[model samples]
Target: MSGQRRTATRSEHALEDLDGAALSYAARFAEQSEGRRRDHLRDELVQLALPFAGRLARRYRGRGEPLEDLEQVARLGLVKAVDRYDPERGSFTAYAAVTITGEIKRHFRDRTWGVHVPRRLQDLTIEVSQATAVLTSELSRSPTVAELAARLETSEEDILAALESAAGYTPASLNGPVGDDGPAELGDMFGALDADLESVDDRLTVSGLLYRLPARERRILAMRFYGNYTQSDIAAEFGISQMHVSRLLSRTLTWLRQAMLTDTPPRWESTGAPPEPPDAVTVSVDRADGRVQVGIRGELDRSAAERVRCALVDVVCAAGTDEVLVDLDGVGFIDAAGIAALLASHEAARRAAVRLRIADPQPYVRRSLIVAGLAPLFT
Candidate 1:
């Protein structure tokens, strides 16, 4: 009894503190004009009432409503209550509680239903539910519709309608477990896949948008957007700074969004002349799904090393591929110059946060990399 009294006293003290804070904030709000100070006081006022609103929200939880979402709705309600509250009307705590509870109830009435139904049935469904649970506990079994009606002091017809409307509270999952004793799922009863796959249009749209970007840009987008990599993570991969990644991402996405709005080719693609082919090495860049494949077919010696290095670095940065597979199967040799190119590309990929790999290296090429002690780097 002593412990309970102490807890109650502590709660009372906390409430008093909150009330004092709120009144102070209100006084400050009235004194200030439209400025940062007034906004700050208003925010502090809302913060003070959030705890009370949270308690009110928890009362309406667990009927398939997410508590976090309810709390957010309740917080919004508290803000409204704090805005409209008058000290002359009643205590701020009582007024805020009523406002917050109304918001939560409004959430259930307007948004919680998975399927549309009559508003009267929707409200009665909640009443019927509460009555059913109480009667079930008292009788030690599920209550009949007639018993629920009697308990709720409603007609049997109204009880049946509300019970039927209860299905709108939660939509049944197609993949949910089915049958009392079997392992079958609800989806197992369905037929074959839909002939028109839903992802086709999305895939085509994304593919079209991605194709407009250079290989390095594509790889960056893939890493940042598709891979959910942070700017710092991408910077570490590409050996670039986080600021550079941020600018690159911002500019690229802005361009894409603008192009989408205008329904025209982006400025990069609008240039009259096509990009000149790399002179020293033959470079072919291809993107499928989210992967960028760069095929290099030629002797990777000093004469072609710089070209190869530049081509590779460009591809790694621009490809927008989750994983870059460099097909080195056609390469006949690799000297120090070629090794330098490989190392440079590898380091660049590391900084950009791109996945760079040497795919199907020929035996001679492998020996050259291994001999130069560079084999471990290209995986």
Candidate 2:
């Protein structure tokens, strides 16, 4: 015990010697003129105080920041103290120790948190941590939130919030391993892809396609699929035979499938109704200037599309006709079927080495062609 006391006494004497030397240097440094001599004095002062700054930095070790980084901060603070020290005010040793410790604390307050935290919460977090350590030592166990709150003289809610905010100081990485024995990571524990999300686009597409169908057919589809009605029930509701309902369902589904596959959908037609008479659509063909002009009148819908297609194909396939112009000045409306008919005629003309063009389409017809991506054919 006597030897230990002697060692501590010698250590205190050494510290006193260091403090006296540092004070004398600081006083001389402040008195000296601004030159190499003064700079040399200031540098010597910093060198003399380095071990003290290093000891202060060590107090902050195991607090998430690297020891090297803390030491760097402390050295910076020591330099600042040397440059701004006033020998008349107080001891240089006391001023530098405060400056260096404050610098280290400020580094933790501002730079260590992984996420932005309110200054109040940050200070509270440190208080809570210190309180936890003290309470754990006093009670020999972790303290409850109420005990912490009483010790900190704050509400339990504030203590809880501080504890939660403390987690933001060092967030766990998602890429980190989940367990000690396996390759699985923390990210792998998250929820998997939702199967229903994959069908969102298809559902939207089908909704638009369903709107394009005739009202009766739309109702039939809704009853069968949405209402969960059987084919016989649908046939009974519509006053049609079960076989007819079956055939209509088959054809409608086939058309919907084909429509969904293509950028442009097919036009809907009623199989129960009789075909439109040939006189409903008029096709007039005239040969002029080595080109056949085929003038079509009336609505170029599904009813008239086939007839128009056949007439245009015949004119295009004629050996003498090098070019054919299909005029649509009188056609008030056109549908997907009409566009399909025009496409078929264009294909036939291509095979026959004849140039087919569209001319004099009305405003509505022109817009329809543009929408169907056939405006270039008219130009």
**Candidate 1 Cα outliers beyond 4 Å, as residue runs:** 1-14, 137-143, 179-379
Clashes of 2: 0
What's each prediction's TM-score? 0.42, 0.53
- Indicate the TM-score of model 1: 0.42
At residue 293, candidate 2 shows an lDDT of: 89
lDDT of each: 0.79, 0.84
Writing each residue's lDDT as its tens digit, candidate 1 over 273-336 gives 5432222358788888888988887667677899888988999889776678888866654568
Query: Residue by residue across 1-379, what tens digits does model 2's lDDT show?
Result: 9999998787666566766876788668768888899888877777767778898999989977899999999999999988888777888788888999998988998998999999999999989999999999999999999999999999999999999998999988889999898999998998899999999988877866664555577789989999999999999999998998888888878888998899967666666674333237799998778778889976788978999998888888883767788889867667799899999998998999988889999766798788887787884
Query: Which residue pairs of candidate 2 clash?
Result: none
